[model samples]
Target: MAAIVARENLTYKRWDFPNCAGRIVNMDEDLRAVGERIRSLMPGELSQRSLAERAGMKPDALSRALNGQRGFSSQELAHIADVIGADLHWLVTGAVDPRRVRIAARHAWDSDRGVRVNPGRAHDEELLGHVVHAYNAAFPDGPPPSAPLSDDPADMGATLGGSFVRKFGSVVESRLGVDVIRLPMLSTDYSLTIGSRAIILLATTPNWFRSNWSLAHELAHLALGHHGGDQAPGEAEELPADEFAAHLLLPEELVRQHDWQAMGEQGLARFLWETGVSTIAAKNRLAKLNIRYSTEVAVALKQSTPVAVRADAGDERGTFERRRAIILRQQESSTRAMPPILAEALQRRVEDGAVSPEDLAWVLDVSVDEIDFPEPDDSAAMAQAYRQAFENRPSHADLEAWLAANGKPAR
Candidate 1:
């Protein structure tokens, strides 16, 4: 029988452990017996200490508990149960079948559906299962993808990192609720889908639309349950599960509803803007809907590169402006080396009060010069004027020596 112990005193309550008469046990020997059972189901080649580490228990305490020198507390026993997927009752009182608990937990989703918002609709588990099955069908003989992907480029990188925690931890913890404990970043590019977690990481270089698409796409993978495994189809083919996810989330109906067939690239762009979808995603979504566009004709529609979005304000708010102003003001008089153009940019930002000149210099790849800096009486005015004077400089090559001398990256 298994028993539930309180965290403080390690009290035990008899619970059924399959077909057996319930019995209460308090002896240290009983605790060792439970520890031995945990050791057996856990991964082979793992010692009591290693198992303890895996379950976040102290090594010495685990050793003592296994040696019948210490009692097993409820928290410790619960952690062990979680690690080995054992039933609490079985771990504590030697009552109740662990299998029954697993079955019950899996089935419980039907009532709650794992989607508290919409009960009638599909739950995350079912959606994930669908993707898994589809992927299996598509690639019956081929190896599965290493991680999930969000069609959105903007979010793909971060999403993958976030998804790693979500897939392994509880769904409740991952979605709709914030995890108070933040997981460290595993990889910047790829998503991790270990266990129940499903993550999608997007590159920051991509625009928000691309990021959003990647996130959505990766979510589809999890929703469809596209975990790579032997039970699914062979690897050579396009997994049916993945297809189901793509089509389901990026439904064909959305494209038809938007009348995408008649829109040209610009028109499509307009439509996407109206619909709040990225131009790239809109095109892909249309393609998935069996709509076609001429690649040759899809010329550059946006005025600026995606990188510009991350850049600061042109003359007013850039880091470059701030650094320059600070250097010029600090110098009481001109020195052999003029402030680098990078410094000028930093100075401009400092004058604008966006950031301290020092911070701006550091970011703009400038370092403090060893020589005495100027002390302009009207520091603010000098910064603003310098910003205007050098704001239009084509390049920052002149600042190379200053940057090198200061041990900063050349901007």
Candidate 2:
């Protein structure tokens, strides 16, 4: 007989069967144990009724199940797990799946809220899982070439130049060893740290400036160690991320070097063109530094478009047209180009038969028919060798005599 012990706390109550040795002896015990695990996952502020509503289950039924008075169906458990962002396997088996990618932070533009928000949806989690798995399979020994960036935002900003701004995503991937993938389906940018490596996913956008800012913001989250929770981050987390990005793009010392108040609109335009940041970002950075700028010029710059700013900055006509064409092409496509290292890794996995061509196509945002899979390897020789080895194996009588001589049992 197992001794059932009740453990009570301010937030929840659970039963611990000390003598059961982690075994569920009966159906009743199994239901109760599962219920306890679910209850423990719920936030202190969230009630059982609220959880049921989120999971689309009847409040009474959920309450009964949670109280160990009724059983929960597999469908109901799955719904609950999805709603709470809990791993279904872990909820059922009491173990975390190592293959799944865990997001540290997610930043997305919320039109309704008119701010960047972090929803932490389950679909994003699954997509990241596929990416992280492919990355690990490709580099089983360790990550590719890497150089750690400076922790100080100002120092880092001073080091990065115009070339880095032009190829922000690629520079981050190759130099920082952070995998950067741009997918149109994602509404948010995600940052994940798996072991010593980090991965960043950006929502596809044609605006190069916005994409750069998003990348920098996700990098800031990683640098600050903001391993996010199920809930959206408030001002405490969002403010620092924004500040870090500001310093990274426009170092305060560099900003102070120029006489912004005297340069007027043309000077502001040049600053914007040089820094590769939006007007609002530049305005805020100035405000933070208490650097006075002409209100008239600031307003005019804010109203001006990116193209107008480039023209005002006196960029070459041919260069401007070429950049515009590139931006137009980017806007037309739903998915951006994959990082070169990531593409190489996925292709290697396909060749090794560790992943299917269909999987590669999905990750690359292309059709499976478009993928060119390598020809199947010839296994005839290997099969013959295996058959010969099997035929030359020891017989059962010889194995029995060996076991007897070794003082081992033969079942």
Candidate 3:
């Protein structure tokens, strides 16, 4: 598990492990032996000292509680039950209580589901199961991809969302005919599936690689046949989606081609950057395949920057900002560009009297005569002048930067 963790699995939860066995534990009978129950619930490898700290009990106190030498307070019992995911009442008395609840598994959307405003158990196993089935049925293994997928990860989105939508995005839209939309409303949130379309996320991560991984992650949900319509996705479907993402983003062939043991820090860094998978995803993928490699580079990558993507922007805001910048890149000789966001903010500043006419004149490179300020209450003229002020303010180099970054060579 530590090896897999070092590798970083794609989905919020590692789908390879059975949730029931790895996390949610159910007891057939109430445990008469409280100490045994705690030990049984915890992974065999975890230390007692670690469990003690988790349970908010001192080492000796935990031993006393486990040994039945001392009775635990309600608070202590709650913490203990939480750590081991035991039914507090059942752990105390060897009887089932209908009211008893295990703290760990109580939440409707715990480990994999994470957080959601409204989630329904809406994973379509049959629909998801049919995907590979459909592929197998169409081509029973003879005809592989005409050519190995050979696009750099950075160019995945082609435009707009960048890493958030890579090659799979084309399949989702062109082949599947699903709608892929990017909205600023989801700036701080991850993307979702609405019926068949994929929501290419931009706000979840500040870096491009993570956002792109999310792009692949959400695509996995759709690929796995999660028809989330208007409701949020259920926890039941999270595992497969995660597993699909890990395999899809970092294919085995790619991993094998570049030997990890051979690829030291620099090579690994290049591979990590090119692939754009999270450090955790890469580590866990390697561990899952039982492939061993140097961890020094992986650890350093983890600590340095969360931004691992070569994609244009780390998140959606970057995309929006870039697009806005791109628009103003085409300077119409006399018409310089002012960024929309900056224009709005500047307008606010002007109204606040923080920006005088001198400032506006200075920004425009013209005298006060050329700078136009509409009457205080004239909202329409004020807005028009504000926009004009920005249109006449952006430099030639600023325009070129936006164009060049977006792969559009300046004419």
Sorted by lDDT, highest first, which candidate order results?
2, 3, 1
- Listed per model in order, the count of residue pairs whose N, CA or C atoms clash below 3 Å is 101, 0, 17
lDDT of 3: 0.47
lDDT of 2: 0.68
What's the residue-level lDDT of 19 in candidate 3? 52
Native-to-model Cα distance after best TM-score fit, residue 231 in candidate 3, in Å: 6.6
Clashes of 1: 101
* TM-scores for candidates 1 onward, in order: 0.29, 0.60, 0.34
Q: Give the top-scoring candidate (TM-score).
A: 2
Displacement of residue 111 (Cα, Å) in model 1 is: 45
- The Cα local distance difference test for each model comes to 0.42, 0.68, 0.47
Tens-place lDDT per residue, model 2, 1-411, is 434433231122233467755653334655677778898778788888888987777899787777666666667788888767666767776654433444655555688888866675666667666667666666664445334556677666545554476667767776667778787667677776544466787878766667778788888876675642334345467778888888888887778999876776667666776676777777778889988878756675666446535545345885677567556534633356666776777788887877678767866778988988876556977888899999999999999999999999997
**TM-score result, candidate 2:** 0.60
lDDT of 3 by residue, 131-164 (tens): 2232222223211221112123323333224232
Error of 2 at 360 (Å): 2.6
Which 10 residues in a row give candidate 2 its minimum summed lDDT?
5-14
